[model samples]
Target: MKVLLFFGLLAIALADNTRFEGEKVFRVKPVLDEHVTLIKDLAKSIEVDFWSPENAEQVTAGTDVDIRVPAIYLDLVYTMLQQSEMEHEVLIEDVQRAVDGQADTGPSPRAHSYTKYNTWSVIESWIDSIASSNANLVSKQSIGNTYEGRTMTILKLGKKSSSSKPAIFLDCGIHAREWISPAFCQWFVNEALTTYGSDAQMTSLLDQMDVFVLPVFNVDGYHYTHTNNRMWRKTRSRKSGSSCIGADPNRNFDAGWCTLGASSNPCSDTYCGATPESEIEVKNVANFIRKNKSVIKAYLTIHSYSQLLLFPYSYTYDLAATHNELMSIAEGASSALRSLYGTRYTSGPGATTIYPAAGGSDDWAYDLGVKYSFTFELRDTGRYGFLLPESQIKPTCEETMLAVKYIAAYVQKNLY
Candidate 1:
């Protein structure tokens, strides 16, 4: 009876995983109004997954849209694309194949390695161990719990000081499936601790300013992506009377809450929560920032597969109050990042650079008087999209480190 029960549990676990066997990711370039309309129509008619623009509504003329279409809809999508004569190419011929190839092929190790995409369980253990390993440079505090009861802790990195020191809050993995985001956060923490005394600039920055790193912000959704669906991108909170599980935590912030570039539908990929700060994860971070508003000088949020550095005013086209300074700083940081491996990064405001994404953490942070708020879209232009290989993790994180250090040094110098 016990053997039968064990096999039954194993079957249930295997059944819960969502697989993508023959799904294809396509990059559609719509240069005309009709082409844009056709893309939107395809989304409305079929179960198309928008990969880049976040949703079908954000598709516009002169912008490249990346979407994943299931095997059943392949013939229809091909017909529509050929009929419209829209410029399109298949980025991934087989999504499952790409997903399988993203990770290294080896027995999973118990220890955490910065170059590999670590699971939530592995990351949680690493957080506790890393914080305790270096008491002087690192200390952690749980801000709150995620919707699925995962503890959200922020690792504070800096030299011990007598009085309260100014801080810069950096968070990663807010979108869950962007595995590289959390990887970069882990790399940043490791780099800071490992090169403290040897690297002059790092030593100076840590001596003066505290850098708070949230390795994985959307803990629940991140865990779901690993165990159930590899493409899951939102929280895992269940709402009454609605089958949709989670909201876009990035869009659940209070700034310009759901005004533009966000969907009111609970089923959307960019669903703004029922109300601002609805997701416990967002509220937990928001409350912490509000409590330390005076000392937090800059906010940096990491994301993937765009290779862009964006600043405030994603909710609207209007330029930020400190637009000139922000642009200059972003340009310099981009240059520093490019110096490492010639990885070019376009730096500009979020709305103008990419698309109008309302209620983003960067925009919210800037509005809350954290003048130096910025969002990073790291690695490839779209060749791999979110399925960036584990092999590129080292170079990606190394180049990004230069850009982040550039921003930190500037913030430290300008602090009043």
Candidate 2:
């Protein structure tokens, strides 16, 4: 009886983790209309997961589309690619191998490390401890609870002041699978606290402006990725009649909600939710921002797997009112980031720089008077995609810190 119970528990544990055994990630360069059509057709036919560009509809000529094909459809996909003669290469030969190899070897330390991918519980504990330790520099407040009942806390980093300070709202891990996004947020917090008095630029930014850091925005979805599916991108909310779980928190915002580059189908990775602010997580952040819109001069949201620093108007092709200045600031920030490791990052409006991803938090924030809104797609373009290795975390975060500080400084200088 005891042996049976032990084996039963082991089986349950193994069953919870969704393994990507022979799945392959391919970077297909769609140069012609035919190539784009072919790619779209393949998505309609099989369960092709778009790693970059987010979905099939966003695939266009001259852009390299990275997709993950299931093991079962590998032969079919290969045949189609060969017949079409589309330029393509395998980014990840086996996703399971990449997942296994992404993390550092040996057991992870019990304590959270900035250089490693920490789970939600670990991050939560770290948030509490860090805020407590750095009482003068950081104070945490629970904005709200996620759909899964996880407390969504934002750490306000600045010296305590008698009068309210102008602020920048920075959030990471809007998309659950982007572990590096949240990692960078943690790094930013650590860097801000540890280098407060010593780092002149950081000290000035913190002293003058309060920066609200939501380390992991989609807390429930992030927790799901660590415990169950490493590739889960949406929230874990369930509808009554539908079996599909979660909506893309990034696409659930009110700005051009459910328009281009988003899907109405709940099962889609980029599902825009039933309505704007449908997902409780999105609502939580949106509500918090709305309440503090007066003092929140800038908004920055972090995402990963595509090295691009994008500004507003993702919902439309129209130029932002402050386009020229935004572009100049982005260019400077990109230059600052590149100085560290020579990791190139393209800078421009979100729609033109990448695909038009409507309902993005940055676009929503921009329309709500946060003129300095920006979204960061960090790390190697597509080599590793969502499964970036632990080895690159330190370098990625270190360089990203420069760009973020550059933006904060710009916002600080321009505040009237």
Candidate 2 backbone overlaps, count: 0
Model 1 per-residue lDDT tens digits across residues 298-352: 9999998799999989999999999999999999999999999999999999998
Overlapping backbone residue pairs in candidate 1 total 0
Residue 335 error, candidate 1, Å: 0.4
Per-candidate local distance difference test:
0.91, 0.90
TM-score of 2: 0.95
Q: How do the residues 153-185 of candidate 2 rate in per-residue lDDT, one tens digit apiece?
A: 999999999999999999999999999999999
RMSD of each: 7.4, 7.2
Residue-level error in angstroms, candidate 2, position 148: 0.9
lDDT of 2: 0.90
